[model samples]
Each structure stands twice: as structure tokens, then as C-alpha cells.
Target: MATLNGSPVGLADMQALALTNYGHFTTMVVEDGAVRGLALHLDRLVGDCRTVFGAELDPEWVRECVRREVSGCAGRRTVRVTVFCPGLDLTAPDLEARPCVLVTTRPTGGVAGPLRVQRRTYHRDAPTVKHVALYGQIRLRRAARLAGFDDVLFAGADGLVSEGCTWNIGFVDAAGSVVWPEADVLPGVTMRLLRSAHGRHVTAPVTDGLLRSMRAAFATNTAIGVQSVAAVDDVVFRTDDPVVTALREAYAGVPLERL
Candidate 1:
């Protein structure tokens, strides 16, 4: 079942959200009532609400809402929290614009296999906030899927790779140092957690030539912690690389917090 601010979401609310897609959201998997980087998720919600709605959202209220939704869940569960304004960004004569929180849950399983991503030249508008408007990116990914690729990795007009449709991409050089693309991309929560565990990493222009030359590559997101990339448009990578293995282990070692 889906919920909104500790209450059930109905057809009217869903219909309203479809009109004005001006909101920020975050999604993460909660396992056995524990979450990784819980504080960071809360911070993202509060900060993004302030930026998008010109108002402050209480982190405690968010947690309480989430707790009420998933209070009795037994296994891995997915939670999506969104903050949006009512009345389609315009308040009525007696109404004022206030950000509303929406929470929903579903059962989640393990991560998928290594992804085979196709390169697409695309860029996100804001790149930082996890907003609601994403049909453009989703459309690109759908087209890539229809063509046999597992997902799409966005590139810039300058030929620099940024990130994936729903994840952050990373590469390892011959020396075994993790290299992230130095471009505008969403900084995923799992990406941040992995970076903290990975001692040190570098960022550079991830050009197509660089993608072809990298020793190994992987994708990171809340849905998939650190998944090896089998190929990036015919340029193959070693899924069993030692760097990828170590990262997977480090990510598994990250402690979880009660949700």
C-alpha cells in the first residue's frame, strides 16, 4: 500500500501531482527497519524542501511519517518520500503554498546484475535536487532499453560522461584508484556513503576515450550499492575486478540506523 504523510494516497492527490511536477524527493531501501545513511537522507529532504518550496520541512516529521508507513514491515522495503506544493504551485484566495510530504512503500529485493549501459548525450536541469520532473531522462533510458542496452549513461555536449539515468557511474584506472566523472550529476546517497568508505578517489573528465581505457567501471545508487558495469557501449570492463570487489565489501560493512 502507498501512503502520504502517514495517510493513504488517493486518486485525487496522484492526479494533482501529475499537473505541477515541481517537487523534490528521495528514495532508499529499508531492510529490517534499518537504513544506511539515514541522517543524510533526512538532510536531503529538509534542504531540498527549503530550496524548492521556500519553506523549511521538519526532519522529525518526515521520520515519523516514514515510521508509521513501514512500522511492521518484515524484510527489505523501498521508501519514497516527496515534498510538493498543493494547488499546482498557486494558492487559492484563502490558501497559502505549503510543502506536503508523501511517503510510499513497496517490497524490495536484491540488486540486479551488472549493467550494460549505452552512452547518450544528455544533461539534467538542476542536477542536484531530486525533483519530480524526470520524463526526459526516463524516456532516454526507455529508448536505450528498447535497443538492447540495460541502461543509459548521460554524456555532455563536450563528450564528458556525467552519470546514469538513476545512478552514479565510476571508473578505476590502472593504478586502482576510483575515478568519478567531473560533471554535473546527481550526488546519490549511496555514492556518498561509498566515497566515505573508499578513503580517496579522483574526479576527471570521463570522456568516451577515457571510458574505453578504464580498467574497470561500476554504478552506485541506493537501489544498487555498487554494481559492476559489463560494458559501456562495446567497451568491456572486468566485472570481477579487485577494486569492485573491495568496494562491494566496504559498502556491505556500512552500519545501518533504525528507521
Candidate 2:
């Protein structure tokens, strides 16, 4: 029961669909009609889908479907494709393979700058999946904008930092160690890759001093590969710090795969 570009898509239209109890979406950058990081994005999409849905999915099929769809696109463009569940019980076999909605090839707004951050208390269910249930994030963004900030950082009732409304939060210590909150935050794809390659440590309940020395801070999501953090609550850091530069380069060098 998925619709692509307002048209109903048949089962034969795709090789596979990743379903989850919570909604999910994906963003891709396309140039010359070719999608970048198709394999990596699909791998993550399938993996998250399986984890949230509590079932296994075919990786090869997902890859082929994305390939088929993107290959049909016509010209240089930046595309974002999103798939969401229609609030049905994901445990059902039929619903497991059918996404409620599918959107593709929309324009990316613009490159965001150093975000002005406002702290708030908000939590989400199934934080790992890229779901469409983003009311909290939407509200937080509007609040941030009205408050003259670019984004919002959520904290738990325990006075510990959770994450940004739309991105993972990272901090650097005076000792040059890159730190992030523990598993409470979404296991961001960029964070996972960076942690795997760099072996950085994840700390619990981020702090102010630690956030300040952030020598370099950035956020990673599907659309923006790695965006630098310029200022947080009027506190600014050197955007070109070696640690930040190295991470940006390392992330760029890792070849994207479809697995």
C-alpha cells in the first residue's frame, strides 16, 4: 500500500520493503541522476528496519529496488527518499513488507550553519529508526527558531544530555578525547562509522565543560554527510581543529557499500 510520487506502487514495483513498528525515512544525495552512498544507506535502512520490526529482511532485494528507482531518475539533482509505516501492526506478515508511504527525489533545503541550540526535555520511542513520527523534533525546531537558535538539544529528567533534535551530539575533552552520550541517543550512522574507525569513547550525561572544548563538533545524518558545529549557546570552537578535520576526511574516505 505504498505510494511513490502520489501514485500507488505495486508489489512488483520493488524488490523489497523494510517495515517497522515505528515510522522510518531516508535521505540521499543525487548528482547526475546517480545516488551517492546507495549501498551504505540501504544497508542501514534494512538493518534498522529489521531491528525495529523484529524480523529479517533481504538485503539484496532492497539494493536492487533502490537501484531500479534511482536509475530511472533524469538529471543532476539532490534527492531524498523516505518510506514510512501506516501505523499497522508490524508483526503481521503482510504489513511487514508493505510500507504505507514512499517519497523520493525531493530538493534539499540548504547547507545549515552553526546551530544556535536551546536545551529542552523530550524523549522518543524507537529512537534508532529514521521514522516519520517527528512531532517533537518539529516542535523543538520551531521553538529554536523563535528563540533565535538553529536547533535544540534534549536532556533527560536526570539532567543528562540526550541528543540533538535531528542529529547526534559529540563533545571533546581537554585531553583531545571525543565523547558522546551512551546508548540513550540514536546510534547514528555517522557516529557508528566514526566510532568503528576511530575507537572513540561514549560517555553518559554530557557536560558543559566537555561540550566547550569540543575542538570540533559536527552532526551526521543521511542528507548532510558531516556538518561542522560552529557555535553552541554562544560558545564557539575552532571548526578546523585537527580532530574534526581528520574525522571529516576519514568519513569521506570510507567507501559506501550496499550490504
Candidate 3:
């Protein structure tokens, strides 16, 4: 279920990640021999490697590593690829790093529905990169869940809705256009895939005030696909909204690529 550079991952190989926690990763869902948005996922890994490690990563090698981990898997599975330098010294930081690729897989769970989230005013460090530092997001998620919410929705200091703990959020305007919030959030692969399939959509600022005029909202990611947002704080949206249904259908219709 876990491999480091196509071989079994060892505890010693995880030292740097455990101590320094400096790395980037991507989570994807692979089914049988095919993956949705496989190219985008690899592109993200390659780009994040440059940003985080100041080094180039071979996307094809990463692809083969993923394929090695998920080959002959029955049904659906969640695969995570993490890139980090195991030999990095904190005192004498090396700019030129040879990062290691760690691929792990687990059985996929049933997609949850109608997320009820609490909005918090926070933003991630290097929000654009999918890095391994997740203490802040996990803390907020735990607090939200303890307070009777399913998850957390992060907003900027100006009260603009940005993203979820691990996914991107989109809104359906009164005119039935998909409104993606323009904020410092990770450009999600699922969001891009949905945008191409959903014809009428726009990128705009989604504020707490704007949510009142919105017709409905949904969360997008590889795991849940298009999941309706039932409530944000006290505001509630209908889970069966037609626009949300259309988005789900569009995402489902997207062709899966072979790995």
C-alpha cells in the first residue's frame, strides 16, 4: 500500500517529513486502470516540485510510480503521492534537493453528501501549493466537527469565501451560472475538469454577503466529486438544486484517462 520510488517505503526514509514536514503532495482516486484528470494531477506534482524543492520532477516517472502502486486494484482506491527530501538538514539547508516520491494507496470510501460547514477567517501559507503542512486546516476541521459541523470553509480576512479544508467551493448564482471564488486557493484539478464540462460559469468574488443572493453551492474534489453544500454557518441551501445536479452530471460525464 505504500512505496518510496517504486519500492517499499521504510521508516528511515520518512525522517525528514516527520521532523521538518517540508513537502508537497496530491491525492487522487484511481479506478481499475483509469484515472480522472491524471494529467492535471501529474502537472501539479511537477509544478509543486519546482516551487517546494527548487528541482525538476519527472512526471512520467511519477505516473509509473502511481501505476505501480495501484495496479490490479479492485474497485476504487485513493492514491496519494508525496514529494520530499529525506536527507535535508535543517541547519545547512540545501537548495538543490533530490526529492523522493512516496506513493500510498488505500480503499476509497463512499462519497459523502450535503456538507454543512462553518466558515473561518484564515488562509494557508503558500496557498497555491498543495504542501504537506496541514496543522492549521486540521485544527479548524476538528473544531468545526466538534461544534456540530461536518467541516470547515476558510475565508480571507475580507470575508470572501475561499475554499474548504481539502477542496474547492463553487456557487450557483441566481442566473444559474457557476461562480468560482477568486481567492488565494489551490486551483483544484476537479474544478478545472468541471469548468470545461459546465458551459456557463464565471470566476468572481464570493463574499459572506453574496451567499445570501446565491441560489445554491457545492464542493468539488477528487474524492467527493460534486457534493452539495447544505449549509454555511446559518445560511442553508437546498441539496437537490437543479444547478448542482447539472454540475454533478457534467463531472460524471467527463472521460476518464488511462494511467
Q: Quote each prediction's TM-score.
A: 0.95, 0.75, 0.97
Q: Residue by residue across 177-244, what tens digits does model 2's lDDT show?
A: 77787647776667767776664666755666556555666666656656777777767866666776
Candidate 3 per-residue lDDT over residues 78-152, each given as its tens digit: 999999988776764675699989999888898887999999989999999999999999999999999999999
- Pairwise lDDT winner, candidates 1 and 3: 3
User: Once superposed on the true structure, which residue ranges of model 3 sit more than 4 Å away at CA?
Assistant: none
Q: Per-residue lDDT for 45 in model 3?
A: 96
The lowest-lDDT stretch of 10 consecutive residues in candidate 1 is 88-97
Model 1, 18: alpha-carbon shift in Å?
1.8
| Best-performing candidate as measured by lDDT | 3
RMSD of 3: 1.0
Candidate 2 residue pairs in backbone clash: 23-131, 24-130, 24-131, 39-257, 39-258, 40-257, 116-150
lDDT of each: 0.87, 0.63, 0.91
Tell how far residue 144 is off in model 2, in angstroms: 0.4
Find the number of clashing residue pairs for candidate 1.
Answer: 0
Give residue 115's error in model 3 in angstroms: 0.8
- Name the lDDT of candidate 1: 0.87
